[model samples]
Target: MSYFPAFLKLDNKKILIVGGGYIAYEKLEHLLDFSSNISIIALELSDNMKRVIEEKSLNFEKRGYQKGDIKDFAIVIVAVDDIPLQARIFAESKEYNCLCNSVDSVDYCDFIFPSYIKKGDLTIAVSTSGASPAVAKHLRKYLQELIPSSIGEFLQEMKELRKTLPKGKERMKMLDKKAHDYINTWSSK
Candidate 1:
């Protein structure tokens, strides 16, 4: 089955992560790129995880996940190695109307994390549904290398122009041409 790729506005969204191991840490890193309203629960945290949590001062608990831990969350990420635990949390997520992502378990996922590149205001995502994340990651890396370093500045200039320009077909045409011309210059590099 194919999954749809969508960009969710995570502002004010509360996220719950149900582990503190390596996989959980990876998910945490990715989520950090967009939102900081995350809380983690684990029976025990790895030393590295502990350091990151302390540095960021994120809300966390050193205990087994409780039955109701997912109640107030907008999204739940089950990164524990235990399949049963992941399944249980995924089931619980439905009852709470929260999106759930069970690592390595496609059947229990409402969403899968895509390999992505975030440069300033630009975010490009590459996904292979549930098939192969490694391929997606490699593709994202290749795409990232091709994007020019001046892209962020160019995008910012476009933003200012959009705000200052009057609303009309002419303004739109000019902006479109400008964007096209900017992209055309990339091939020369």
Candidate 2:
């Protein structure tokens, strides 16, 4: 099924990750930049993972994931290798009306995490509807090379301009024009 792509504002949002293996660590690495309010539950974590939790002072429960452990979080990510456990978590998450994503299991996911390129405030995401992650990664790399480092600074400038501009179609037109002009100039450089 095709799904609409959206960028979620994760600042201050509670996110739960149920696993502590390499997959879970990889997800945590990305999530750390967006949200500080994260909770991790797993029976055993790798030394590196434990160090990260300790250094960051992140909330961690050294136990296996429970059925209702996901009830309080806005987003839940299940990265365990066990398919049955992932499925169970996906099913149970529906009871709490929370968003769930089981790694590599699109059938059990409420949302798929796309391969993305991030530069300061600018972000570009690429996905192939879970058909081919390698293609998504390649596209992300291509975009990374295309988007200039100055784009982040340009985005900041646009944000400041947006605040000063009046709220109406005129403001949107000006913003779009400014952004278009900036990108055109950037591409020429």
Candidate 3:
């Protein structure tokens, strides 16, 4: 499947996670960096997962999946290993018209989570459409090594400069040239 690139605004949004295993913990760790309003519903939670819940003060409900658990959530992440359970959650999430991601199961996912490299506000996400996660991970590793840590600062600088530039085709041309020049200078130094 051809995937479109999009950025989600999850700040203060309610997110639901339907598992507490290692995969669930990994998903929670990633989400914790974005939103604090996360609710985890699972039959049993791992020690590390419980610690994270307590530390983040996240809402944790010790229960099995229910039909309407995903009703009010903006996004639902199903990290459960059971295919049947994942399918059930995916179906329920569709009824609520919310985005759902089933871990390692692209067929059940509304969107696939990419292997990402995050440095400050700069995030580089690499995905291979679930064809090969290892390839995506490898690409992420390469990007991590190639991309400078100062990219976040550079992006901020560009944003600030763009606001002051004239608004027209000229502005677009100037921005493109300036970006190229900045990258060239950055790599040379």
Candidate 4:
């Protein structure tokens, strides 16, 4: 099935990760880009994983995941090689009304991570509805090269200008036009 594309605001929300191996570390790296409010449960952590958790001062429990560990988390990511555990966590997460993502297992995922580019306040995401992650990664890399380094500064300028302007349809239109023009000029270069 085709998945919906969305960018969640996870600033203050809690995220639970049930693994501490390579895949878990990769997911943690991605999550760090957005939110630092993350908790990891694992029987054993890789050396790099332990180092990262210590460096970031992230919450971690060095134990196997329990049955009712899905409480209070806004999102849960299962990255273990154990398919049964992944399915179990995904099911448990559903009962708690939490979104779950089982990496490499689309059937057990409520959502999939999109390859993305983040520059200041700018975020661009690419996905193939879980069909081709490689394509998405390539497209993201292409965009990373295509997007000008000045785009972040430009966005900051736009943000400041927006605050100075009155809130109205005219202001919205002006901002829209300004952004479009800026992008058009950038793309032509």
C-alpha lDDT (0 to 100) for residue 36 of candidate 3: 88
Instruction: Give the winner by TM-score: 1 or 4.
Output: 1
lDDT of 2 by residue, 36-149 (tens): 798999999988789889989999999998778988898999999899998999999889988999999888999998898888888788999898989999989988887888
Runs of candidate 3 with Cα error greater than 4 angstroms are 186-189
- Tens digits of per-residue lDDT, candidate 3, 151-182, equal 88888888887899879999899889987987
Which residue pairs show backbone clashes in model 3?
A: none
- Which one is best on TM-score? 1
Query: Tens digit of lDDT per residue, candidate 1, span 53-114?
Result: 99889999999988999999999999988999999999999999999999999989999999
TM-score of each: 0.97, 0.92, 0.89, 0.94
* lDDT score at residue 172, model 1, on the 0-100 scale: 96
Global lDDT of each candidate: 0.94, 0.89, 0.88, 0.92
At residue 16, give the lDDT of candidate 2: 96
lDDT of 3 at 82: 90
Model 3 RMSD, rounded to 1 decimal? 1.9
* 117 Cα displacement, candidate 3 (Å): 2.0
Better of 3 and 4 by lDDT: 4
